[model samples]
Target: MQTMKLTIAGKGEGDDAPLVEDLIGQLGDFLGLLREVEDAVAEPGEENEIVWRVTGATRNSPLSIEITAFPKRHGMNIDQRERKVRAAAAHGLAEIKRAPARPDWFDDRALTKAGGIFGRVSNGLAATTIDFGNDLPPVVITSETARAAAANIVRIQKPVDRPYRELGSVEGYFEGFERDGFGRLVLRLRARLTNETAKCILQGQAAAAFEERSVGEVIERGRRLVVSGTLHHRGPGRLYQVDADRLQLLRNSGLPDVADITDPGFTGGLRSEDFLAGMRDAGSA
Candidate 1:
């Protein structure tokens, strides 16, 4: 709680400062006891401190005791701090009863970890919620809590099926290439089908062939070319590239054409110029 004002019965005629200081000293003793209780009950890394505001004391006949509390950084669970304050308050009240001369009138406000002391004024005591600062609300996630959430998430397995088939000469525009850690080149291309365009990846020897024919021209200019190879697989989605081997580029000079070549199956080591001509003829027929 940022500020707690207690109505300590002061010897009205005497110096009010000394009386407030004495009451503050007594409160500090109570805090020491509260600390012990907190240490036993609170989780590790939790901390708290007490402060007496000397200037906050009333100069008038009836004195006011103002004290403040500050807790160390913690997780988002604000309720924990509120619980600690309640426990501390209960403990402090118990100690006050043991005092030989307890304050005739006092404030019993429910202090919060976020520096808030809230209560309605009753019997000459002005208690209310104290707003310390504009700090945003906390994100409550302990290590254990995070681990539990992770454990509850569902995982999907990757699909696997492999039986090589002829994918014939596929026509597409070259996008780019990336060499993996294993020294194997990966070619990314936009394969234009009869009805739709598919993003394709040519790996290993097929990718090497394209690199050799183009002299890595595709990597620099990103040209559109025709590639012929054996289709290893179509992958999970039909949109996946037809994994091919023994690949050959049909048209290395970035050209867009409506080469009507139906799934001509796997064309291992086929020449691009001849394949393009045959496909063009087939389209005419």
Candidate 2:
């Protein structure tokens, strides 16, 4: 429920401004209530009951009223988690800021300590991938089979199996929903990288096993990696480094339909990397 109220310093007829300040702007005429204060959760089905109170009224010493508006319960159930994924592919973290917590699958990842929010948006990309079927193709798809129509095109990502969240630390997880031929919500269990910091870390590990790629590319690839963490109503989260290249596939073998991931809620910034043809070839243009 989107709830809010106001308390006047001295005895005076309180205008809607101070109250709406943290909420809506100038309502012009009609006073804005619920949605204005905190737009975190979206209004679900109907008007939700929100409790509130205002202090220092002229006729009354204090004013208490119940406001009703759309229920802002942005959450996902095993029956419907797709809404969150669609939001993630584009909005990313911003999408997370607009929902609520529902149920879970696994025993408990981090729910006891924290209350509502999740621990971390699983940064484990390897845990979630688009399996084009069969021996999964390489990260850089170059085969004629690379057509978008590949029958094996499966996006594997699910919600956290648990629901607990600690303060600072993040856990590895996956997308909070499921998909069918077009992706479906069957089971919603659920469920960073480096840079110059890489140079510092790799200073001595030159013998480090690396493929035929520039050090920068390797580091950039590593930087693209992330530590997945779920956001919880209790607090922020804990983080865990997820492998990058591993995200696209779980080995040469494509992820079977049985594969699932643990996605908590939000993800952290692993710093920007110079990836893709666009960034490196800027000089050619």
lDDT string for model 2 (224-250, tens) is 212222223221121122122112212
User: Best by TM-score, which number?
Assistant: 1
lDDT on C-alpha atoms for all candidate structures: 0.40, 0.22
For candidate 2, give the lDDT of residue 242.
Answer: 17
- Residue-level lDDT of model 1, residues 1-285, one tens digit each, is 334444434333454232444445434543443344444343323344332233365645445545554434433344455455444445433323233111111121111111111111111122222222133222222223323322221110122444335556665556666666776666665543321234345666766676677565555443545555554443322234555564544444323344634444545456777778888999999
Candidate of highest lDDT: 1
* lDDT over C-alpha atoms for residue 171 of model 2: 17
Rate residue 100 of model 1 by lDDT: 17
- Identify the runs in model 2 with alpha carbons over 4 angstroms from their true place: 1-9, 12-38, 42-58, 71-258, 261-285
User: In model 1, what lDDT does residue 228 have?
Assistant: 56
Model 1 vs. true fold: TM: 0.26
